[model samples]
Structures are given as structure tokens and as C-alpha cells.
Target: MFDSRHIQTFAEVVRTGSYAATARDLGYTQPAISQQMKALERAAGTPLFVRAGRGLRLTDAGRLLARHATGILSSIETAHGQLKAITRLESGRVRVCAFPAANATLLPATVARLAASHPGIRVELLEEEPPDSLRALREGRCDLALAHSLGDDEEGVIQVPLLDDPLLALFPAGHALAGSGRVGLEELAAERWIAGCRRCRGHFLAACARAGFAPDIAFTTDDTLAVQVLVAAGAGIALVPGTALPLLRHTEVVARPLTPALGRRVSAFVLAGHETAPVTALLLRTLSEAAKDLEPAAV
Candidate 1:
């Protein structure tokens, strides 16, 4: 049987395209790399690499083995992680990613609750946008990612809905529409707008399209506090997420529900089979319970 180390070296060489580079990456000498390659070839009973020009190239057999090696390495890593988690469910580490607003509002409460219930479980949190959060989950950089879906559902990921956070209109206290209670997107079409990030801008445009008019963005920003400050100073109106309300330090800005509510559907994503991890299950429960108070009341 080929040693795992030898197979790993072969994979690294395949990836790096040079035995010298792979050796540098893996902390092995050039001779050691050669020994590993030779041993792997011996175990396979065939030469895996062939000299071509100034560099080496993989044989057809080598290419086939490299494809299988990726899955094998991934499985080994997953098994090791599972074993570590299972052996210490309460004391294990759970790495999580969340968008900024949720990290500020809901996640802190959930983390507090989880710490109270499972003090030994070390939960590491990463703040990222929805796209980055999903990427982290796909790459196994995080155990759970709290993300907001605009429309697309990620394949190979299991998403558990936590809550719906509506986009509300933020107006200066003395603005004519401030006291309207609720307003339609059409009503604000002519008003100068404070734009958010790319995702937020997309949602804003989508909402406007539904209302039959385009918005004229006067300024663009993604900082929650900056958006509030700009809106409060009468730079422009904005559609801010409900979860971001808590982050607004200015009382000069008021949030009113939209005529036809448009918003993000927040969910927690985990790798297809990773939801079974004891810590993941526990944290999911905690997050769900914490989100209960954030949901809108039935009309």
C-alpha cells in the first residue's frame, strides 16, 4: 500500500508543478521529495511522472491517481475533525461565520446562550458577507455560516431558516414622509437615495423595479453607521435592514415598514452531512431560539 505521506507529496507536486516548489511548501528536501515520488511509483508498480522539457509531467495513470487522492485527503481531514468533535462535544470548538448585522444583534445573544449551556464549547465567530459566508462553508473553513439569501439557494448545502428581516425605509425625522408610517417604493422614486453595498443595491433595485421606477442613488456606502449618519444629515433616504436598526446610534433617523415588504431571508448553512455534529446541532438550536424575537408579528 502507498503511504499517505507519499500520496500527499505526489498531490502537492501535482499542484505546485515542481518537486522543488512542493518540497519548499511541505518542508521536505528535494532528495526527500524524490524518494517519496520513487516510493509512490514503486507501490503503484509504474512510473507516475515523466520528464518533459525542463519540467516533469504526469502520466495518464498519475493523473487518474491524483483525482482519487483529493477525495481521500478530504475524507481523512473530515474524519479527523469528526473524531475530535465527537470526543469532546461540550468542549469542542465550533467555527462560525455571519454577516455584520447578525453578528451585532442576533449572534451575540445566541453565543451567550450557547456559552451558558455549553461553557466548554469554544465558538469562534467570523464576520463576512453572504457570498463570503457561503464560500467559507463550501471550503470547510467554517462549521456554520449565517447568510441572507436574495434568491439563489446554494447546492450541496443545507440551509435552516432562522428569520425574515424586512427592509424598512429610513428617513430624517423632519422629512415629509417620515410620519407616513409605511410607504411604497413608488413614493420614494424621486428622492435622493443613499446606496448600500452591492448586495443591498441589488435588492434595492429589485424592489424599485417591482414598483415601476428606478432610484437615483446620490451616495453609495455599506457602513451601517455611515448610512444612518448620511440619512440623518438629509444626504438621502435609505432602505436599511431591520437587523441593522440596533446599530443605528442616531435617533434622528426613523425606520418605517415598506408598502410591500421586501427583505432578506436569513438562514444558517452547513455542509450537507455536517449538521449532525453535536456542537453544530446545539448551536443551530440556540440561534433559532435567539431569532424568535426578531421575526415580524402576524398581520
Candidate 2:
């Protein structure tokens, strides 16, 4: 009979594309990966892969076995998830991957609420960008992922809208628009801007473009705090989520709703089928509650 261990070994090797990566991923030695592959091949009575210079290619038989391996691995995962779900609240870890903006604002309160409600549920948090968060969902690295939608839901995740954080203007307290409760986007036409990730979400850039000006980025950084600090220091003005405003308060910065204001919607994601996990459901509930009192940054 094809053993579970053999099926897993084959899957890891294929998933990672290298024996070394499989070893690191599974926390096994390279020799152990080799041993498992040999045993799996012996069970199938055929060689599964042909070694190339630094990589290996699956044979036709290997490809056929891989097809079966997928189902086998998925079944095993389902069984394990079921067990975890049944026992999770009593003693287990819930992993969450969140984006930077959430990290600054709603996330801390949400996590605190969950911890207070369910002390037994050990929750581990990871800060990842949208695609990385979604990848964690697909690859089983995280139970729940908090991320913003880039307007495309192509990752096949089950996404639940968490809350909307309006995009706001972030600038030094003394900047021209600081005293205004809100300012029109078009008013900042010629100001130097502190850009967010250009490669990922075009939201910040798009907002500027729609406002009829292209930002001359004085600096670009992904760390939300750093972005705020730079703007506070008068390095440049930035457009940021309302969530980020609270974190930037001590720096004497100001945040105001933009005219034709845009909001970057936050969402929680789980792998399509594993949405029923108790910890995930509870945390989602907690996040919703936390968002209610989130007054956006007062400044």
C-alpha cells in the first residue's frame, strides 16, 4: 500500500521544487527527503523523478502519482483540520496574517479582545502584504488572513469584508492642509508625496492621479509607521488610511478625510473550505466588534 509518509514526501518535493527546500519546509534532513522518495518509488515499483543538474523533473509515472498524491494530501489535511477544529478552542494555535495598516490600528484591539475571550486559544500573528497573506491562506501557513482587496478576488479565498478605513491626507501638523478637517484631493496637486507600495496597491497613487496630479514621491516605504514619520518630519505629505492616523499622532501630524474620499476596504480571508474553524470565526467576530469603536485618527 502507498503509505501516507511517502505521499507527503512526494507532495513536499513537488510543492517546493527542490529536495533542499522540502527538507527545510518539513524540517527534515535532505537525506530524509531522499529516503522517503526512494521508499515511495519502491512502493509504486517505478522511479518517480529524474535528477537534473540541480533540480529534478517528474517522470510520466511520477506525474500520474502526483495526481493521486494531491487527493491523498488534501484528504489528510481535511482530516487534520477537522480534528483541529474540534479541539482548537481548548488548546491550539490560531495563526493570523495581517497587512501593515491593520497592524497599526484595528488589529491590536481585535487581538486583545480575542485573547480576553479565549485564553486557551494561542494566536500567532504574522505581518504580510496582500498577496503574501493570501498565499498563507492557500499554503496552510495561516488559519486566517487580514488583508485589503486589490479589487480582484482571483486568489480563490473566502473573503469577508472587515471594515472600511477611509484614505486620508497625512502631513506635518504645520502643513497647509493640516488645520482643515478635510481637504480636496485636487488641492494638493503640486506637493511632494510620500508614496506607499507602488508595486502592490495603486490605491494611493490612483487617488492622486484621479485628483488630477501625479505625486513626486519624496520617499517610498512600506512600513506604515516610517511613512508617517517621514511625513511628520516634513519630508513629504502622504495619503494614508484612517487607521494609520492614530499611530502618527505623537509626531504632530494631521490626517483629514480627502474630498472625493476613498476608502481602502479591509477583509478577512481563509482558505475556501476551512472557514468553519472555531478560532477563525471567533477572531472575525472580534475584529468586527473592534472596528465599531475605531473612531479613525482624530487628527
Candidate 3:
């Protein structure tokens, strides 16, 4: 077996082009570096390096070992980083996939809390809808997935309840129903509507159906900020998830709770068998705390 230290020293000598420099960089004496190289050559049963005019040059065996050493050393370093991260949540990366609303509201606070508590940890947030987010988690593209669904357990993924976000009505400030304490879907059926995302629009459609009317959808968009902008411009009213309120950039829009208290449950998804990871568990705890602190919607 090729000793990792020998391979590491060999790679360092190749990079630095001098045994003395490699020794200095690695905090070892020049003789120690020469001993490691000689041991590596004996293990290979060949002279791995040859003396050039002023520096050491790699032989064919040395070149091959150097190429393999680079990848082996990289993998070992990555493993060490992961192990360290697991041991103390000190350093590593956590990739998170979340939908737009959750990214806007809960995720920011959760990420902030985790980052403050564990400054060495790196967090990556990707925006994806429920289905895509779950897919990313299953494909190993993300460590955690924040999703919104109608309280259904998906196969192969474990769901951890994060929050129950109510769907609310949003309209321009001057709209007749804007100031209402609560708005019924049936009451606004005749007005033009800015349809939200596919899932959110489906929920709105179902609610309108239950209320015995079909909404007149004037436009469809998946962007929460754009929805707010359209509503502020009086393009139409919208049924927005409660979490989207924080993303509203337009002050002309007013949010009112839906009369029947319709809502979707937001949950975090991870591979069914994998949930005890140290960084993931830590972030999940922070997310739970942020969810608990969220303001409850008025019915």
C-alpha cells in the first residue's frame, strides 16, 4: 500500500520542485522529506525521482503516482472535512432546497440563526417547488428540502411538519373587498385574478369550486413579488399563501384571511432513512424555532 504521507510528500515535492521547500511548507526537515521519498521509491520498487541539473525531476512511475496522488489526497481531504463537520458542526456545506415563499419568510431566519451559531458551516439555498425539491433531495442534490403540500406523506421521503400556512386574499388598496376583515372566495369570483403558482393556483381553484363559482383568471405567474406587483397595479386580486406576505414589495396590496381558513402544510423532506445528520439536525432545530415564532394568521 502506498503510504498517504509519502504520496502527500511526493505531491508536495512535485509542486514545490525542491525537497527543502516541500519540507519547509510541510513543517518537516529536508532529511525527513528525503526519507519519505526514498521509502515511497522502495515501495514502488523503482526510482521515482531523478536528480536534474538543479532540481529533482519525476520519473515515469513518479508521474503516474503524482496523478493518482492528487485525486486520492483530494478525496481524503473531503472525507476529513465531512468528518470534522459531523463531529462538531464546525465546517462543511449544507445544501437546502425550498420553495419561493419559504425561502422568503422562514428559511432566511433559519439560515441566519444556523450561520450565526455555526459560523464555519456553509449553507446553500436553492429555490424549487414541492415536487422538484423532493426530487432534488432524493437525487442527493440537497441535504434538506422545504416543501408545501396538502398534508400528504410522500413515498420514500420523510416529512417533518414545519408550518401550516393559510391561504389569504390579496387585492389593491382601493378594491372594494380590500378592507374586509375576511373575504370569501365566492364574494370575489367576478373580479379578475392574478393566478399564483401551479400548486397555489390549484388550491385557489378548488376553493373557488367549493364556494360555487369559477374565478376569472386574467393572468398567471409563479413569482410572489410579481403577483404582489400585479395586485398593486389593480390587475386583479390573488389568493396567496400566508408565507408570501413577507415577499410583498408593493404597499398598495392588502392581505385578508380567507373565510374558510384554507391553508397548506409546509414540511421539510429528507430521504426516509437519513435524518440524523449533525448539520441537518441542527438546521432543522433552528427552522422549528423560527416556525414556532412565526405570527399566526387571523381567521
Candidate 4:
């Protein structure tokens, strides 16, 4: 419980071996130096100095405190410097959780931009879909989350809209609807479907329900590549986000926009009070810019 200021005065007194000289060196009056020593002795429960004929001599307790003061002060200074760096965006770490499609499309560009602009700000990425990413964000495991929702609101987080990822219809190259400019959900009502992650499957089911028919989902997987391969092999047709298409598209799979244009809204989520944190704000801005760059291809 020793005061830092008292410890500093004590260290200077020990070094100078004279109360008046220590006060002069520290720009404090000699009586002020003496008061600090008395207070420090009270906190330490032992004497820190003994009179030594017009000078000062350290007691055993004083020597012990002096031995450790340098390290303590150095650690305090280091902490201050690091905090300043973080405030200036010269050094920091941001943990980001995102879905697979966003990892493949949006993250690369965003990370690249951050690295180019702020090399000292490190980014760590984890892959998880909407609810899971949102869960991670709420649980304090991640600083930010790149999640997409079908117009659903999440609780306890601030959502910053980034882009709209339209769902595109996928079919085998020679399928009857492959050459169509656009296809409606009702037209494929009888076809077996390849569904993706849980949220995506839910979106698919809802879109189908709105179209007035239930789809028979035959295959389920989270991998976009596998989804494309299944559609190419004619196992079933599927609907995938436009962001996922550019990352992995099978040559024999034809992708066309859905006639009714079903899509999910992608956003960056941060804890309620963390939106203005330096690293978090920088990442949010970079993500928005990256999403804008992908607009032409995403639609």
C-alpha cells in the first residue's frame, strides 16, 4: 500500500544521501521530502532512514524498497506507453468472428487494407455463422463479428450494416432452368434442395414458404465448395449467397438470381459500449470499405 510518489521520494533520498539535496533534485522543499518519508514509514511500518551526521543512511526496510523501486517504476512507464500506442492506433489487437462466406470474400480485403494502413494493429479471425458469431461476441470471446441475418434483430449488440448478400439459384449446367435469366422459388418446389448452415437453411425454408411450397432438402452442409459440387453433380439445386459464389463456383454449376431476389443483410456487430474503441472503429471502417468494393460482384 505504499504510495508511488512516496516511493519515488524515498528512492531519490537513498541515492542522494541528503534530505535537502534529494528535495532540490526532485524540485520539492526539504520539509516536503521529510513529510513523504514519514508517511512512507507509516505505510511500511518501519523506519526507512536513520540520521548519519549531516547526511542520511538507509535502514534495512529502506534498502529493500529501493531494490524494487526501479522495476516498479519501469513497469508503470511501460504500461503508460502501451496505453498511449493503443489510443493512437499504433498498436492493438482485434478478434473477429465471421461466417465462411464472409471469410472468403469480405475478410481478405478488409484485413489487407488494415495491414496496409496500420501494420501494428493485429487481426485475428475465427469462422462461425451468424448466431454462433453473435454468441461469441456477446460472450466476450470476440471483439467484433461479421454476421448476416434475414431481417432478424439481435439483442445486446450494435449492428452496423455492411452489405446485402443476395441469394443466387444454383443448378447443373444442362438442367432445364440453367440458361434462365432468373428463376422463382415455386418453380423448384418439387426439386430436392441442398441446404447450407442452420441459418441459411432457415432462410431457404422461409423463402420457399413465402413462395407457397415446401422444398425437399436432400443434402446439408456448411461448405460452399461442397454445396457447389453437389449442385454440379445434379444431386439437387441450391441457393447460395453471392459472396460465396465468387470464392468457389463449380464450372458445371450455373448461378442465376432468384426471381423474387431473396437476400440476407450482412453487418458488423460489436458489444454495446465498444463501438468507439480505437481498434474496433478502425476495423468497422475497413470492413465497410471492403464491402463497398465488393458491391459490383456481390449483387
Q: After aligning candidate 1 to the native by TM-score, how far in Å is the CA of 264 from where it should be?
A: 1.6
Runs in model 3 lying further than 4 Å from the true structure: 1-82, 295-299
Off by over 4 Å in 4: 150-152
lDDT of 4 by residue, 1-299 (tens): 98888888887888888889998999999999999999999999999889988888888988898899888888888999999999999999999999988888899999999999999999999998878898899888999999988255666678999998898988999999999998988899899989985655777787899999988889999878888889889999988889886765568998889888899889999998899999999999999999999977978
- Ordered by TM-score, highest first, the candidates read 4, 3, 1, 2
**By TM-score, is 1 or 3 better?**
3
TM-score of each: 0.70, 0.68, 0.73, 0.94
Expressed as tens digits, the lDDT of each residue in 1-299 for candidate 1 is 97888888898999988889998998889999999999999999999999988688999989989999998888888888878756666477889999888888888888888788778788898988878888988888899999886367678889899998888899999999999878988999899999877765677797799898888888988788888999999999998888887787898988888878888888999998888878888888899998996565311
Best by TM-score: 4
The better candidate by lDDT, 1 or 4, is: 4
List the global CA lDDT of all models: 0.86, 0.79, 0.84, 0.88
Leading candidate by lDDT: 4
How many residue pairs of model 3 clash at the backbone? 0
lDDT value for candidate 2?
0.79
Model 2: how far is 275 from its true place, Å? Answer: 1.0
Q: Provide C-alpha RMSD values for all models, in order.
A: 13.3, 15.0, 7.0, 1.7
Supply the global lDDT for candidate 3.
0.84
Clashing pairs in 1: none
Instruction: List residue ranges in candidate 2 displaced over 4 A.
Output: 1-88, 295-299
lDDT of 2 by residue, 126-217 (tens): 88888788877778888988887557774567788877878778778898778997799888888888886766647767777787888788
- TM-score of candidate 1 versus the correct structure, residues matched by position: 0.70
